[model samples]
Target: MAGPSRFVVHVPFTAPDRAEARQYARMLARVLGRLPEVDPAEATVSPEDDQSVHSRLFCDRLLSGGHRCALRAEHEAPCAVVESDR
Candidate 1:
């Protein structure tokens, strides 16, 4: 038996700035997360010129029982799982 294989998909798009780009990435992640195979919490963004460097869009902190935080990165509030509108 083997575990599920994982991979990364790079989506290149132009944004007015880094902040806007991050916002777009987070939005895209949330929408895509509706699918069973998409893990939006693990989404990240990087500049087109320097793809090697990356910035996480979510806090994604490891919680008890193997769960992860669902808040934005560097959030001040306590770690929690945010419910999405279905």
Candidate 2:
């Protein structure tokens, strides 16, 4: 068995406000959550600072061992940033 799969996804951005940040984080989850092999609920992103956040995605045996490498890279794709004017 390949065991559990872990991938570190980095979400980088400066949110305009708390609401925007929460929405953005939720957006990130929705995208990655669509992946069938991984439990989207387990995937999360926490702000590292004003400029960035780190996302951790979890997958069980459903994910091929090689798939873990792609998780982070795939999540990093260009995503539109939503922020409040404030």
Candidate 3:
């Protein structure tokens, strides 16, 4: 079988506090986990990039939040495959 693909999700953030990055990452992980194609247990979220769209979405969703999500589906699949393999 073909290997799973690798993708990148740019979670954007602006003028966020130090904790904001990790918080946004966690929130993003939860949201991404909800995706139909995503495996909740296998799903992983991290500071993939600075000033990313996902980070911005997290921030934007809340009154004080200003994180905007930029998830690219195909890239993250490999991680799921890797997680499952382990």
Ranked by TM-score from best down, the candidates are 1, 2, 3
Which tens-of-lDDT digit does each residue in 24-60 have in candidate 3? 5555665666665653333334453533322222221
Off by over 4 Å in 3: 39-86
lDDT of 1 by residue, 25-83 (tens): 99899989888888899899999999998999999999987878988888899999877
What candidate 2 gets wrong by more than 4 Å, as runs, is 50-86
lDDT of 1 at 72: 85
Error of 3 at 86 (Å): 20
Residue 47 error, candidate 2, Å: 2.8
Error of 3 at 20 (Å): 1.7
- Highest TM-score scorer: 1
Task: Specify the highest-lDDT model's number.
Answer: 1
- lDDT for model 2: 0.49
